[model samples]
Target: MKLTRIAQLGAVAAVAALTLTACAANEGGSTAPTSSESQAAALSGNLVGQGASSQQVAIQAWTAAFNQTNPDAVVEYDPAGSGTGRESFLAGAVNFAGSDRAFKVDEIAKGGFGACAADSGIVEIPAYVSPIAIIFNVPGVKSLNLDAATVSGIFAGTITKWNDPAIAADNKDATLPDLAINPVHRSDKSGTTANFTDYLSANAKDVWTWGSVEEWPAGVVGEAAEKTSGVVEAVKAGEGSIGYADSSQAAGIASVKVKVGSEFVEHSPEGAAIALDASKIEDGRTDGDLAFAIDRTTTASGAYPVFLVSYLIGCEQYKDENVAALTKAFFQTAVSEEGQSSAAKNAGSAPISDDLRTQSLAAIDLIK
Candidate 1:
């Protein structure tokens, strides 16, 4: 996905003139409310956000819908990786940040947000939920069954060939290729990498020694690519190559069915929701911070454990009231039912449940 920048900071007369008519009134007559009294009062301003290439498609959808209501709101976002987004947000280079993972408890404790007033808290809302696909490219082989250990061994560079006994054992029906197995990984620091590594570290700790990390471990060897698209391209170009990425971008690539208890499960919006329902919010977070601790080791039926919960990170209090209003309004739009449906249609992401949406909106309301 390319950088998404939508600048619609000009007023529409029809939207600005919108007013609410009072229905419950005396026999005198119904009266139209003033612009200030109308609940649909339009907002106008520019908002800049950076981070999480995984959210590029969803952001595009969101900005488009946000403009329908707030036509004068300028929304610009750069799909720079997640790490850069967090750093930029902390530095006050952008109004908000999008990250696959929320800031750690220690990082929040430090509390020096440049965009916020002194001693203000931060708000992190899980607005996007998606499954990470294990995509592969092997000639004459479009599908294969992969378990945690076999996947860990392949990515860890322990299993070099496609016809290895471990791989062959799970895929007895498919023809095992004798070609070399090439694994591709993200070169940059990424939340997707964090989620992928978390799953491996939890289920395949014996083979994958490294714990959950945003950066690829130095000792682990593989073909390195810059972002999600780069990894997809690398796997597409290389024969017998495999990589993990957001399911939306893994459309053309052959995906693996990961083992979940007694059955092999494929990645989908429903499957991702199942995995998300099994997760819990992290402890030690403020009411405005809805950071999730995903249950990556889940074996529940129809659950796709390798999923990511992308967050929209912002300050609970901004230095400027206009900036605060714009940020809060945009976040409200993002977590709204309409916004979630738009994302589901455009990005193939699972819509957050009604309960989660209500919680997210309440958190966004805390912004000032």
Candidate 2:
């Protein structure tokens, strides 16, 4: 469950500069440490997490806020790909892991999360939810609207030219030059790729032949890059290039407004949040675990289907007591209203709903 609410900046690209709330002292002048101080005092030593480069901006905000309250708590999170993060967590290299996709049933059954106690159930909590913008660098095309079928064709390598009628039909007013279209993709194992492909497969199954996968499939033609940043950079360097990335990183590029049913919708924090609200948890995932099954066939007029629901995964019971305690505290601050606000300010992400907050807090309580 995610309690965090992601909000607006500009075109969902200008992350509104976050203003810090002043911490006023208590009126009683009690020497007793206030709640914030006590939380800080309660936490000491380092906590580490690794995964999902898309969550880097949010992690920075969450960690900074955590450190202010608990100066002694040194939390370090490495923005490695989701595959690396999951590998590290299962190998006991990190106390917690952040991933765009939740653990599969087979993975949960394997029982190799080295940090967990012998019989501890995995706690998969949905923390960050945001839109993955379809960013492009096409000359004279400030805004191009493409429907799912056309998008699938371009990414699938069937639509090679920018001025192709299939694309031109979508953006009739935009002067799409007769240039070769280069589709940049993530070469590395990435959750972003998984979600992006999932959207394609769901909305345009006939055109997007390659099904949803973390790694790009065989015979799929595209300029492959290492990670989210690499994909963006690759697209930026090439003329008439297009790539998909988290909306936060798409500041300089022209993001496409995707056609969802009758209307083309721009990516916004509220737009993304509405999609999540309409989604449901996956089947067989009960108790404290949360793995969202986003319906990519969403007809929610303004909601964006290319959204990522990032998860912060940990063990219900840890082998090291301190790891469990520290992990719990870090996440507690992560989903709090202040923590959610920090994410919005830094990443332009939508905040999680209130019911999700309650379920997430309940899940956190299980981290014994």
Clashing pairs in 1: none
Q: Report the number of the highest-lDDT candidate.
A: 1
The candidate 1 region of ten consecutive residues with least summed lDDT is 13-22
TM-score versus the correct structure, for each prediction: 0.91, 0.91
Worst 10 residues of 2 by lDDT: 2-11
Candidate 2 per-residue C-alpha lDDT over 169-240 given as tens digits, one digit per residue, 9 for 90 to 100: 878788889999999998888999999999999999999978889989978888888878998898889888
**Poorly placed runs, candidate 1 (over 4 Å):** 1-40
Output the TM-score of candidate 1.
0.91
Please give, for residues 1-368, the per-residue lDDT of candidate 1 as tens digits: 24456433211221221211122232457554322223366788888899998988888777766676677888889878899999988988898999999999999898888878889999999999999999999998989999999999999999999999999999999998899999999999899999999999999999988989999999687999998999999999999899999997999789999999989998898999999999999988899999998898888899999989999999999998988888888888778776787677767899999999889988998999
